[model samples]
Target: MATHAKLSPSSAVRWLSCPAAPLMERGKPNTANSYAAEGTAAHHLADQCLSFGYSPSDKVSKVLAVSSKGIGFFKHDQPNKKDIAFEYEVDQDMADYVQEYIDLIDNIMAAAKAEGFFEQALPLESITGEKGATGTADAVLITDKEIIVIDLKYGQGNQVDAERNPQLMMYGLAALNEFDVLAEIESVRLIISQPRRQHVSEWTISADELKAWGETVSNTAKLIDSLDETSDLTDLFAPSEDACRYCKASAECKAYAEHVHRTVCADFEDLDAPLTVDDAKYDGDTLAKMFERIGLIKEWIKAVEQATVDKLYAGESVGDFKLVQSRGGRRKWLDEEQAEATLKAMRLKVDDMYNKKLISPTDAEKLKKAGTLGDIQWNKLQDLIVKPAGNPTIAPGSDKREAIITNPVEMFDDLTEA
Candidate 1:
């Protein structure tokens, strides 16, 4: 059996849950993702500002300015400052979104202030578990009510939910032992703020519950260490096609290799065609035409598959069609001059009086309360318009899961060992 150091709680869960992911991680060695780098830089700056106490330094100001410009500021502290970078860029028209993020933090801070729970943010600590395993948390907010642990994620994906996150629970356990205020700790709140989507998710778990979860993490670490180095990856998780998309080891994994080979063979068969002696006479133009036809066929097949899936899931028809209710000819009403002349005789202008704000708010309210206006017409009068196109329905017969290969040993070995 190969004895390897127990992986971090986060990495262990990822490796076990998605076996192929580690292989994928190993394959991309030199890809310098700038967005990731920026995120890391921003997070580090935020951690320092919150932990060491905010200073008016250029670096701190720069980060705060950038964060203020985006949707929201995410808070978390992790080491390997060089490993992960926080790099989520907001769309150009994201002023409102960025303000919302600031508002969320402001609200939390306000609550903390009102409760007298304010303290230095993200106080650092080296937590030592059994067998000298150690890890650090990003930020720790102390309050009169409870301790708040905030984690900032710059990624766009929704992988972490506060309720199910083991890392947050682990941090709570570590804090309990380190601070010796486990009894004073009324509750541990886990906050995950995603700035890209302007989303915030929080989970509050009791200290007792977190302690139990910590024990589970420790036991799982021990079990993982007991596994032999040569143990088949499939023993951990069943191999499947969905694994291939994000698998680092897909290039070398035997299962993935076989699948790719089969796919290639099938494609080759599709390109094969019967040829006659005279077929060679006009080869160039014919070959070009064949390629064009193949491209169109591929597009059609994809569209059909998508439509089928949409129909199955959403129970809606799919295809191009013009609305039958659309008119073909122009229908004219009274001319502006004629209408105005007639209205003038009655001492009323033919202008839109409703748009002119001629009616008082009291009158509008009275009219609305009287129920004389039909629901649809009333809503329209109030400038409430229903969307012409409803929400899109997923096509029926669409494959929900893409093909995946579970075993990543081949790919991992190739990338790492090589």
Candidate 2:
């Protein structure tokens, strides 16, 4: 935001949607979480793997680079996969995921070898996405005919698609600009490896198309620079679900407030009082509008609450609505160890108090704070993930999620059997 490309390629979806976000979020403190820290450690391990061409051994330190030897030993164990991971004690699923990355690179290289390009092709390199961007690409494979820019997403929070990915395109353009033989690289392939989701998506475009996209990135950078130096940003900002969801300026932005105001004010231009859904008379069109705007309205409300909390923490108050604790709520064990000890002393059946039943890998993944569910447990759960047919529901055709597939014959068989 300080005259830099704060609209980085990784955050292009956000800044592009809300042009003035870079300056609006200036001077905000970043709140780092354990997930981000774990991601960083994973990225460090991946970068080291790329650099050294080896995987860490089981003896690699476990304390997440808090120790000197942790980093040193991680670097030392290069190129093979006995115990290669971000954390020292990785889950089996995590091991498989890391191995997937390694296997993917190998597959690409092996394919290149089969096609006879491995000899002259430049080896894959971990690269900064672009000259002006503050992001790095996990790997880039360069050849005379094609350039493949790859990103590895370690977190399972959400699956990322490679199709028309601005992040990967920026990486491709950056890699293109870095290499001298740009003309030889005819096409670019963008790949996103989300091993946890088992979703590896790829998108491809001509080198000319990728170069044209670079113009967009350059323009975005310029726009950010202009916004950063602007006096008043009232007109420059625009708010939408994509832009406002992660913007640090949610609490202070006037544009978003105006958006909320317009949405509600227009909805109730004729109403004398707050109209409940039961009392409201709306057509299909109005109902659809409400449906679309409801999500955004909820988001705004949540952000407003957080902003209020932030101000309250600093000793500010909103009239008489000061923060307070309810007299009664759900209770918990004051001492978890003592509670467990008591349960053991009583000889209570563990299954009565604890869930001994199997849970889905997705559910089991919630227990993984820094690593996988540990050892072969997750791998065993992998076979148990029976993705049943999803219930059919109506949605707009424009929705990006894949439509559910069903077998007519199977349905007919069920009816006949019944």
lDDT tens per residue, model 2, 1-418 = 1122445667676776677887888889865445665666665555655566656333234434323223323444454434433334444455556667767877986675412111112211222222333445677776667887778888896567887876677767766666626447778888888887777888888888888876766676566666545367666687876678768888678888878767775653342345455655588877777676765677788788988877887898777778776698789999989999989899998777676666556557645523656647767767767778767865666546788878999999999999
| Position 219, candidate 1: lDDT | 58
Predicted candidate 1 versus true structure: per-residue lDDT over 10-32, tens digit per residue: 44445445443454455354323
Cα RMSD for candidates in order: 20.2, 8.6
TM-score per model over all chains = 0.44, 0.66
Q: How far is candidate 2 from the true structure (C-alpha RMSD, Å)?
A: 8.6
Among all windows of ten consecutive residues in candidate 2, which has the lowest summed lDDT? 116-125
TM-score of 1: 0.44
Q: Best-fitting candidate, measured by TM-score? A: 2
lDDT of every predicted structure (CA atoms): 0.49, 0.65
